[model samples]
Target: MIDKDRDTKKLQWNIGTGVHYTLNANWALQADWKYNYHRNTGARDRLWGTRLIYRFGEGNKYI
Candidate 1:
């Protein structure tokens, strides 16, 4: 069961950051992190992620 009023009125804070680096014209890398804290429930959450990107076709068209 879930309480709609409590869920909607809950207090929380979230911080997030990410970075992107171009390895080359067609390749790139990215990483991210996030932190969440819930004041009402005393809950904490953390998330970390990474990504690899690639572009097709000719040279760098997104100069």
Candidate 2:
């Protein structure tokens, strides 16, 4: 069955790590790296990706 206008999620391989550094009160910096892989049965079917992220937030929740 298929649903219209509904969000569907697919399975994919992903690995990532992140670190947060606080420069002072009420501010922070975050860095992250990720790898994603997609595979299929065909010989030419392959996908790979990397990602980075920086975020700022308040309080100790950023850690």
Candidate 3:
């Protein structure tokens, strides 16, 4: 059965976090994670990823 009520409401939310680390004056590392919550559909999704960054010009940086 499907609910056709026009007033029906569904709840959804997303939460995420990310971290950035400086490996050197011109290099960096990044990582991220995220999660999704759906109340009405009872479905969830998760994501994670990592990235490497590089700088073209010199600056007061490095890790």
Best by lDDT: 1
Order of candidate numbers by TM-score, starting with the best:
1, 3, 2
- TM-scores for the candidates: 0.74, 0.46, 0.69
lDDT string, candidate 2, 1-63, tens digits: 456433364445767777766755555567666666653322232344334333445545534
Off by over 4 Å in 1: 1-8
The candidate with the higher TM-score, 1 or 2, is 1
lDDT of 2: 0.53
Judge candidate 3 at residue 13 and give its lDDT.
Answer: 92
Listed per model in order, the count of residue pairs whose N, CA or C atoms clash below 3 Å is 0, 0, 5
lDDT per residue (tens digit) for residues 1-63 in model 1: 368775679788999999999888888899999999999889999999999999887647666
lDDT of 2 at 25: 58
Taking every candidate in turn, the Cα RMSD to the unseen true structure, in Å, is 4.0, 8.0, 4.3
> Where does model 3 exceed 4 Å of error?
1-9, 59-63
Clashing pairs in 3: 23-63, 24-62, 24-63, 25-61, 25-62
